[model samples]
Target chain A: MAAIILLGLNHNTAPVELRECIAFSEEDTELALEELHERTEFKEILLLSTCNRVELLLVTDDRETCVAEAKQFLAEHNRVPLDDVEPALYVHEGADAIRHVFRVASSLDSMMVGEPQILGQIKSAYRTATQKKTSGVILNRLLHRAFFVAKRVRSETGIGDHAVSISYAAIELGRKIFGTLEGKEVLLVGAGEMAELAVENLIRHHAGTIWVANRTFERGLELATRFGGRAIRLEEIPESLQHVDIIIGSTGATDLVITSDHVRAIMRRRKNRPLFFIDIAVPRDIDPAINRLTNCYVYDIDDLKEIIDENIEDRNREAIKGERIVEEATIRFSQWCDSLAVVPTIVALRRKMEDIIDEQIDKTLGGLKHFSETDREAFDRMKQALINKMLHDPTMFLKSNGCLGDRSLYLDVTRRMFNLDNER
Target chain B: MENLRYLIILLYLASTVSYLLYLFIQKDGFHRAGIYLLIAGVGIHSAEILYATVSSGQLPATNLYDALSIAAWAIALVFLVIQFRYKIRILGIFAAPLAAMVTILSTRLPETPIPAQNIFNSIWFIIHIVSVFIGDAALALACGVGLLYLLQEHAIKAKKRGFFYSRLPSLELLDTTGYACIVVGFTMLTIGLITGFVYAKAIWGRFWSWDPKEVWSGITWILYAVLLHERLTVGWRGRRAAIMAIVGFCVVLFTFFGVNFFMKGHHGQFTTF
Candidate 1:
């Protein structure tokens, strides 16, 4: 019998330094898949390499030999010593391996449990494995099941609904205020990394007309060019405030970049259109007092962090629901794998019964020389009926017991009683 | 006919239950079920109105009972239109209960018959009653939207992220929908009042009756007119606009019921309590 095996190290088991050392690039993954396919021992293979984890899933008849050979191959391919990498490695076989893959695909095994990028990464890995022709029937079914389970977990549960990062939280808050971000103007108060990240998320929502305001005109222009937006000097922020709906402030200024009075004066010209300010800077580029102004909202770094923290708690609660779905799918998949074992046994038993019955009928016909052609045909028909009737009970018994805990024990007993493996 | 009216009320009550389930459970299935029930209720209610009109050789709103029934039908019909256009299923929480309540109230009132008069037979009176009822329905929805806007605004401004925060829509959408309702209601009210004057002149020999209903209707019209003027000119929107919408709806309610119950009016002949 063939067993599904998984050998991998993730962020939980390995440090970034070690994971990076063994992580395979796309070309390296393709090459490694081809190399692994060259060995007759590995019947099917797939390699999933991402920033946080490196996993190799395989199907093999000889588990011990395959595990040793795969570990050795990993050491040689990445040029890392066995002792240095062996402690970080974890291996799963049979049902454990299937559950691990399901959890990984559903993102329950991620560093951030509800993050969505890992499923796309797994899909790309599966695509590469298919292109290399390293994934066979069992693996193809398993990968597709993984995708289905992942989709079920996403829709049936709220695991991926909330934002757990700073930039995402800012966008979530902005959506609450504006109903939608489409065609809403965004002003990047400085070229700070956090503000830039928030703007990137805003642009993803189709926010219109990006404006970058920096103390230095050239720096602002450079950042604005990247977003296909216009640059403005710091002095012009008050004038630009009339049109812009959202302002993201992450400048390095010690003093406040925007004051309450400035926003107060612009609120009339802006026709009381809502203003959202995301202050990600350390010194707080936007004034806290501006939050009190009508139709104006200000969220600083701490506020964003608070929202993220609350959202993370929500995600954690939702993840419990996802785990239940994963558990149900895993049991269903294992039952399917167990059923695969039942089919060939039933076929072998029927074939054995037919061979014995046919041999006896031929021997009897040869002894009777006066037997008519019609009688011979009737004898052949009786032989088939006899074999079918004899095997029907055993086949039914095996199938009925297929989902039991001692299913393999029953199969072993039946195989022994029938002497079904004598030829092998 | 009475059995059909009972069935309509039952369907409206069922719709109210479904919408309430949707609000608390936040399920799309319940919301869809609510919409279907409301549609069935409105369809039967329309047939009932047509039946009463054909049976009596005049408009159906001859007394408080019939007028309230038509009012409920108008509100449900307008709600169906708004739900189809905006896809704002949350608004059903307000609309379904209000329709159900009005339907129940119509059944509770005693049917009083005035002396047979040619005034009730006038085409102008029919036009006046239909437009006024529909206009009142639209303004009622505006009040509901205004309440939602204030709730959402309070949730956002408080920064507490409470239960209503996620349930209510954004302030901008509520404000825009409220403004649309006001514009539609204002236009229909203007038409109703104009036709009302024509009907009054044909019957009472003058357009300006100084009746309580007429006075209150003028007051309600001017309130909405000012609201529209300010919203268009100075952009009095968001919280302020929401508050004005609610206030204007109160005046409309007073004109619809309060003037008849509290003060004598020429329109009192149309609805006897």
Candidate 2:
């Protein structure tokens, strides 16, 4: 196995104060990458510096020495003493390091397990490393495989589905109803914080028309202008409801601001088009009875929380699937590494056999001076057949089982028998 | 010729299995291989038909066996062309099995060819048979697509969000393609009916006969006409249009097979089965 050294401190292993101290700035990272290439014996190095974690991934021939040197480099670069930083550092070597890289790229180890930003952060780290000439063939293949595993985790499981926050839940429910928010209209019944949050999420999903109505006209105008929507008076809510498909209400009101009668009239004017209501206020602003009307749906604060809770649970379940995918990809990548390791031996053995056959054929043809063209062809065919039959079993066995376990002794004996080591 | 027909059946079977694999796996490799296999089957099928036609000195669609075989071939050919035009690869999952099933049924039919001196051997006879078979093939494909639409709709409505939900094409694409199939099928059926009327007048000295095959074909044609009319005028779409397509294909199948195999008619009486 190749030597992989991963030494870093994340939010899980270190306090925020220590993480901030250990984090690499852009200049610090570029200098460290350059210094490691110039001074250290490590073959490849990548520094991933984000707010939540600062990790150094190094590939070298000697795992123990490289892991120690990488930690010292981190300590010296961050201006921290070696003793204090060593206790905070977490180290993974070889296959564990590979798995860590995969899990990190797939976001399985993030503070938010299924968050999507970590993959982009890792990609940028890899891009910087590649641009600096710090990552070569091995690290390049490993990073690309990590990216692929992350993509597989994204598609094969519903890890990125559903919403983890209340406002996002409201938007996700809107998506479930309309399949997309691209052409749907949203009505913000008040300028409350949760309603504003919902509006932000709706805008992110590309909702078309937005109407903000509130009891206070100036406050409504401020919120509407902030979100690029129309500011309507409180009395105009009913008329706006006829045109909007979704209503997010979070006003601070004692009584229901939107009644079943108001919605019934709007429903009639809208000609029975579907309507969705998300009320996040205490003593909800919309009538609960309006939910029973045809093509009408109402979800209050508790319901939105329930959906978020379910979504978190769904993400946890999906994370388990993601872990399995990571393990599967890790095994595949390990096998590829193994095959790469044995390729040199396989090539040397085949060449040795071919060279011996070619020498034997040359000597025999030199001795047969009176042979006809057909006779010469027959002799060449016989020599080729002898060579193929002799090398077939050994070639198949070594190519298939060479990477199984410690078989260096067998490779050494074969090299000696063929005088390959003597040539070198 | 018989051996070549058998080889064609084997190739069709292989293509059908490959298409089934493509559907279940949803892999591009499986789909590409399935398409290649289907093309191979079509090539062998054309060769077998050509051989039969040359040896008999007539069109291969002279009996129930050959007619059904030609129908299957045309269906696969048209489906291949549509698949290339639209890139609706899942269409083959339905079309391949249909072609295979028709060829299988053709094998089970009697092998006796039509008599040489049959009065229905005119060019009008060839036109009527070819047009009607191609039309029926299109309607059958439409029926298959309609079934796929209903399956996808059911999956979405039930919120299964499973394989079928993700794998099936969009509802709008399926509906539009089904509509296109009906338009082409209906046009060909109109031509087939007109040619049949002309040939009937030339031979039986009448334009309209109360033959079971003719009457049922008229009923099938009228059902399709009503389906098209409703789709154009009343904005029939989605599930309603899908159900109509399936029902129209059912009527077509009854006219093509039930009338020929069970009832007495000028069309059925001529073909030895």
Candidate 3:
């Protein structure tokens, strides 16, 4: 029988500071994974390191040995005490471990459930393990099945629909005003992390025209270069604003940059087509009074935050569907594990019984039963019937009850009562 | 013949009631009832047209109002035919209102015997009327789908979750349907216009009179023509095509009723004359 052990921490278990400590830089994650695999007890290991989680997928024989090895591996790498890591860690074994892996890979365990990137992360890790030749029969099968299950959940349910992050919320808000983002222009303000994320969300939605504007022009250039967008300086924003249908502002300015006057001028040039302005800045970079203008819609940080929070609630509503999928996969995996566990015992018992039957039948018929043809035929029939009747009940009972872990005690009792021996 | 005419109106009213029921509560009983109501209405409409033609020795398109009402009924009947073929039950969401409006108005018009007009004698009138109704039917179907597409798309992008997640088709499928309808509609419309040219030359003694109805009809044709070209050649699907289809239908409705209601032209007396 095989067992899996999962040990990881996520947004729920750890503070941001702690989870950030173990977080791998994009360039460093592969090397880190290779180093983590050096533990003797961690035979087949996959490292699922993401922004919100750092899970170790291990296929090991002994639960306690594997757990200790995982804790030690993390402690040594981060230079943290093992005791300090305990409170922030979770340890799930056997059926629980398999379910956790599926959930994590499917993004059901993500801070934002159904984020869609975790499945790719899981696939990358699986490929790395395959390249290293560290994966065996069980893990290879488990992971391949996990991909299908992940796809099933996505195709059958709307768990992955909608955006939950501040960036995704901005993109969604833009879509509401625009009705569609195809070929629509987006003016991203101040090249911040939020702006970069907004760019990601917009690009994914097929918004083609992206303009990045920042106070320090290089920062804008850097983000624009990454996202294939046009970079603009703050002074050039008014000219940029006239062409763009959407504007996302999250700058470090102490005062407002876009006033009612600037907006009125932009609206006049565009002939009153709809414009969506999102202000993600703290202390508000865009003038709040501009919302009074017709055809100009403005949402400040709090307003955008409310939408993001609502997305989180929407995710919770869909999680009920995701949970149903995970629960079904868990029960099936557990049954397979239990059935696998009783296989050796069943094989050993059958081999022992056959040997005893062979010895007695040979001794009785090999020489002493060679009297007449009818007598010899009768002896062979009796010998076969006894063996058939002997093995039927035990085999049937072992397979079904074995899957539930209840057959182990009975097998032990049978072994003692029959005096089953390996030397035979 | 009289019974069939009355039956057409009855079936149209039944369809309207059932569609309203479907809108309020989307259950199997209402959906099935709507489907049966539409099928029955189409049958009655067809029977009434067939009986009127057979009894009076009159072509279906005898006068302007007779032609207008017949064209509207043909559009509804064609939509119902497609619905029966595809079993596309969602079409009732838009089709019922169209059918009821056409049938109810058909009843209100003067029941005076209309002698066959000289314009209705030309072969172009048949093609023009058939093509126009065919295109109108496709546009009506597209509007039905556009409504569903927006509903599904909104539910998804809003992060709001529930049964809508399961009921709606993918955005890709909706896009394909929208593009397909516009293409079919545009082809029929082009033929309708070409035939209208021949019919105008035959009866009105001119190739381009620029009647207000004709002007608006040409504008309507150009709107959908550009939409079709954009969708097929430029890959305009989903949102843009949806918006265009909706706008195009508004133009069609105005061409059907607005010009008839307000403007005085060859098409103004569409239902009264």
Candidate 4:
């Protein structure tokens, strides 16, 4: 049976100096993959090189030799002795390797648990390895399975919800209310860097027709021009409120810029359309009372912070669930791998039985040379039926229980008992 | 023929289940399956109606069962067209079950034969019934969309961010679509009332009567007219307009079935108003 092996140094195992030394640049990764494929005996390989870690995954017939050779290659590439790198490397073989890959892809084993960037980083690594043609069928299936498992973990658990930052949380809430940012109108109430970051999020989500309002006209125009949006005076905000669907307020104003009465009046002019306000200013640009209105919703800085805290707590709890999913998927993948190992033994057993039946049939037909064509056909059918009935139980047993325990032992006993040729 | 009708009803029920799954699953593949099943159901229903019309030598909208079957068919037809055009697939979670419920109710009602009358012979009466049933179906759809708008609004205001909040269309989209359905329904209702007046004059020698069906339909029409008028002139939309749309549809329901079932009217003999 082929083995899966994972060899790597991560943030926990290696210091920063070792990680930097072990890491491969993007251009170097292509050359390294080519050289590794040409020099190493590992049948299939994938190299994942990220800032926090550099991992090498392999599928090979001899796991021990593959690991030794990979460690030597890493030390040689970094111009270090094998003994110098040995203490920093962690090795996982067989089922443990599969579980580790799944954990890595799902971000469970990241420096920061539930961090979203690690999944994307791993995906890029997989893509590069695929393009290099270093990863073949076994690695391809294994990596694709990891991607699916990661996706399942993301959707089933809220690990990626509630953006960790204030501006991102505002964008997340905006999406919850608006469904999609496409064709939505946004009004940025300040020209601060935080507000600019929120605008970046909005643009990333494809928000439509942004309007920038600030106390200073030139500042607002500068920010608006950078984002390809129009600029309006702060005094003109109420008039523009009727057209925009979302308001991101982060101005330096001391007093309230948007009051409950102002929102009420705007609601009437806007025909009671849904309006969302994100007040990130320290003194609160929009009144809290505005949220009580029918179609208007407001979230101040404290509320956003509270939401972010709650989201972090929710994600911590959800990570437990995600771990369980990865565990189940790893076991399923292992079982499928075990099943693959028994297929050849079952095929050989059936072929051996067929060969014996054919020999006996030849002898029987030779003795009945004077029989008519119909009598000869009847004799051949009887021989075939006997062979089928005889082999059915053994065939079922090898297929069903062959992969369960001591697979080599079962194959050995079957070979010796049946006197079958063990060609492979 | 009865078995075929039952089979069509079962298909509608299956389509309803598929649509609910589509909404919950939120998969494009599941949604396409739902739409195909609904289209197949509509096709079977049309065949059933065609078969009935050919064999009985009468219009398919002649009695209570036939009228209801046609109404259910019209509702699914209009919903499918709207879903295709607007791409609001979640609407089927409401529309499909409604069509299935109407079909199921039609099966339970006593499908008694109607006695022949001079009014039934007129082409004007047939046109009036068909137009009125189509209008009622459209209004029913408007009610469903109006409910969706309220639910979405409530989710936003209450901060109950969850499944329905994500699945439903934007408040603006639902509000405008509901308004459009009401407008089209109101137009058809006006034509229905006018033709009913003309048919009444031809059969009974009178254009106006204080019959409960006529009075209730008049009230329903006035209610929707005020809704449209407020929306267009006063710029009334969003929550207030959505509520009024629901209220208007309720009044329409009373005019369609409540008046006929409870009060004495010349129109009740036809089993629909």
Best candidate per TM-score, number? 1
Ranking by lDDT: 1, 4, 2, 3
Cα deviation in Å at residue A353, candidate 3?
Answer: 17
The order of the candidates by TM-score, greatest first, is 1, 4, 2, 3
Instruction: Report the C-alpha lDDT of model 4 over B168-244, residue by residue, as the tens digit.
Output: 87776787788888887899899999999999899889998899999999999999898888878766787788788
Task: State the lDDT at A329 in candidate 2.
Answer: 84
DockQ score of each predicted structure, in the order shown: 0.59, 0.06, 0.11, 0.32
Per-chain TM-score, chain A, candidate 2: 0.77
The whole-model lDDT of each prediction reads 0.88, 0.81, 0.72, 0.82
Each candidate's interface RMSD, rounded to one decimal? 1.2, 6.6, 9.8, 2.6
- Candidate 2: global Cα-lDDT? 0.81
Q: How good is the docking of model 4, by CAPRI class? A: acceptable
Candidate 4 lDDT tens digits, A300-352: 88778877787778778888999999999999888656644556656666677
How far in Å is the alpha carbon of A305 misplaced in model 4? 6.2
Q: lDDT per residue, candidate 1, A265-314, as tens digits? A: 98877778889998898898999999888788888898888878888888
Evaluated against the true chain A, what TM-score does chain A of model 3 have?
A: 0.68
- lDDT measured at residue A314 in model 3 versus the true structure, 0 to 100: 75
Q: What would the per-residue lDDT of candidate 2 be over residues B83-173, giving only the tens digit for each residue?
A: 8866777988889888888888888888786666656468888788778878898898889889988887665444344567557776656
Stretches > 4 Å off in candidate 3 = A16-51, A56-79, A131-134, A176-183, A188-191, A196-240, A252-256, A259-273, A285-296, A343-424, B1-92, B95-119, B124-273
Q: List the residue pairs that clash in candidate 4.
A: none
* CAPRI level of candidate 3: incorrect
Across residues A59-168, which tens digit of lDDT does each residue of candidate 2 receive?
A: 77677777878888888888999998888888987678889999999989988778899999999999889989988666887899999999999998888887788888
TM-score for model 2? 0.67
Better candidate number, 3 or 4, judged by lDDT: 4
Candidate 1 wrongly placed segments (more than 4 Å): A342-385, A388-424
Of candidate 1 chain A, the 10-residue stretch with the lowest lDDT total is A401-410
